[model samples]
Target: MNPYKEIENEILNASHILITAHKSPDGDSVGSSLGLLHFIERLGKKAVIGHPDPAPEFLQWLEGIDSILYMERDGEVLKNHFQKADLIFCLDYNATDRVGPEMQQLLKSTSAKKIMIDHHLNPENFVDITVSATEVCSTAQLIYELIEQSGHADLLSEKIGTALYLGILTDTGSFRFPSVQPRTHEILGKLLGAGVSHHLIHEQLNDNNTVARLQLQGYAMSEKLEILDSCHAAIISLTEAELTRFKAQKGDTDGLANLALSIKGIRIAVCLYEKEGKIKMSFRSKGQENPVNILAEEHFDGGGHANASGGISELGMDATLKKLKTLLPVYYKSDK
Candidate 1:
């Protein structure tokens, strides 16, 4: 049998299925989870989404989002689901630890068969079936391929298409990222044909911004943004106090690094924001020549796509900032 057929059979044979995405979930992870849930429902099966945390405010507008059980508040329910589930689908993230330690332990304890559908590099070997598409723009696109290739193209619906569309859109930087190929657009067209209403999604994602979020972003851009003229790089750092002043929500700083990258002559952008005593880092670059993942992996204990990746620092904010600056001159070689 084909690989997709085997995956389909697992879904068909399983009596109870559990779905999960990574912690600090973004549009791609959250979208893939909900999209898979809707697809599994279309297959006449039951699956529950057990996210490691609540969906950030911007994504709350998504339909069926309320049905998810978060590890933040639904600990008992998540445990119950894991205990009862015979199969689990891990969306977006490659490793179990990507959901964080508490959820990771729960997943490791469970005897359920785990399936991973991810578009990331260096996936671990914990899943029973791994559908790793490192070249795809997003896991949502991979999910679409799985559905289309499994002889279930008829099951595509507006709800499923909407969730997956959000995943593709966000993960691809609104389709401006290099990973987006002709096939990505073709899949998006199919989703649009299924009544996805792409315009509404674009509006919903871009138009919904809180006053505090706006103020915070403005403050960061005006006060915190700094240009490293020699390297064609930009840095934006926000302290915990600064974030508190603005009452920053989970995703208040989204797109900030990209905004910094938009500047003329800037080839790389790094945004470091202090949250809960840890500094979260967002690294972005303009092209393959300025890959930032190695910088993230070696310095910040994180890695992802070359153009876009994330890292975290246990050190204090100032120290992390210093480390980033120290590495910058050596890491990025600006062609321009």
Candidate 2:
């Protein structure tokens, strides 16, 4: 039986609905959640969108973006909604822990029927209904499939199409990632036919960068980036002072790891930036030459896609940098 049919049945019977995505909401998370919110509303159902943290500035222009309640910012109100909800839709993330501490606790305590719609690998078996397809290009594309399969394809208006297109655009690295299938392009065509302005979405996400962000990117590439010729890797590390000097915002370092990957001989790119006393890492690799996901999981306690992943180090700046340098040669040898 199709699990989406079960999900549809749940949605039909439910009244008050709650929607949420992972913390540090990215385009896929926010876009998928908001796209579903618009779909449910069109069905005449009352739904509330909650996010664990603020959506990045670049995604703020999305329709219905402001309607999302930040769990960190509006805890009391979100808690009340959680209590009243008959159904909870968890989007993008595979685990409840990905929503952060407070929201994770509330989700665990809620009696609401939990439905997970994600494209991430190794999902936790927490939700009641799991509609996960790890091979899908993005969760937004999966949401589009869900709505179309559930017989609500007509509900996909321009607003919803735009949101869905944004997710597909970002998560697939502007359709450059190998994860994008022919079906992804088919959906992109349909989204465009549905009145989604692809050029506008691209401009707003990529072209409307602030001068400070560009300056920071320039500084990181020119001064901070280090090339490891032996391992065919590049790394960029930013201390808290550097971030502060650049006036770095939440999304400033979004694609810095990819920039390192653009280096001619660099197969693996790593970005280590300090945030709140811990080193947060983003890893990117070109084509599957490195298997950075395994490197992240084994060394840094993180797991993601084959080519892109993230991890963290509790070690101080210098120590973490030293640790990464130590691991590269060993991991690259084993990977080969």
Candidate 3:
């Protein structure tokens, strides 16, 4: 059977289901979860979203945001729901490990079937049903198709449209990323037709930044920024102390990678952040001149797209930055 058909069958049979995403959920994960939640509730089935932390206030405007259950280090409520769920919709991830150690244990212990819906490369084959279209821009687009396939298209309420639109908008970097497609624009038109307010969502997402965040951006530009190979590569690293000083939240580092790409001669951009004893790296490249995922996977055990990727490293700041300085030239030829 086709992947979409298989997922549709699973949804039809499931009575109680749990939907979740990776740790440090992004707009795609949170929006897709809420979009699915709205669609499921419209079907008269019981659906709930499990998130490790509260989504930022910018996203609180989406429907069913109030119903999300926040799970701590070892949340008993999430454990109970995981055990009772007939199925689990693992949205926007390739592996159960992405959900963190505690949630992974609950998932393994439960009898619920795992269904994966994602738009990432290198899918893990652990789930019972997998519907991954790496060519698609966002998981929200896939969820929209799932609803349409299941004959639930008309059930897409204004709430569902807004949530899904946020997923597409943020994942595509406000429609500036290369992933933005014509179909994405078509979907946006349909969403507006459904009464979803684009201006309000944009304002809520953009205007809610605190003064500390602005100061943090200034600090990053001043202290952390580095241009390598005569601006062929750019990098920024944020220490934990700097994050504390700036009151930087988990997703506050969202646009720092893009900042490097803004340089005229830059081909590759990297952002390294220290969090919980590990250095998290976000990489991006422009055009076809940079092999970003290869550099990340080889150096830091991470892989993503050519223009965007990420990985984690145990190598301390000085060492990691040293490695990036040396390795960047291997993948890119500087016009300088």
Which model scores highest in lDDT?
Answer: 1
Going through the candidates in order, what is the number of backbone clashes in each?
0, 0, 0
Query: Residue 6 CA error for candidate 3 (Å)?
Result: 4.2
Collision count of model 2? 0
Superposed model 2: Cα runs more than 4 Å off: 334-336
Q: Candidate 3: where are CA atoms >4 Å away? A: 1-6, 288-291
Clashes of 1: 0
Q: Cα lDDT for residue 316, model 1?
A: 93
lDDT of 1 by residue, 1-336 (tens): 677778899999999999999989999998898998999999999899999999789999999999999988999988999999999999989887899888999889999999999988899998889899899999999889889999999999999999999999999999988999999999999999999999999999999999999999899999999898878999999999999999999999989999999998899999999988999999999877888999999889999998999999999988988888888988875555
lDDT of 2 by residue, 1-336 (tens): 778777878888998899999988888998899888888888777789999999889889998999999988999999999999989999999988899999999999999999999988999999899998999989999989988888888877898899999999989888888899999999999889889999999999988899999999999999999988888889999999999999999999999999999889788899999999999999988775677888898888787888888999998889998999999988775344
**What's the true lDDT of residue 119 in model 2?**
89
RMSD of 1: 0.9
Error of 1 at 132 (Å): 0.5
Ranking of all predicted structures according to TM-score, beginning with the best and ending with the worst? 1, 2, 3
Worst lDDT 10-window in candidate 1: 327-336
TM-score of 2: 0.97
Of candidates 2 and 1, the better by TM-score: 1
TM, every model: 0.98, 0.97, 0.93
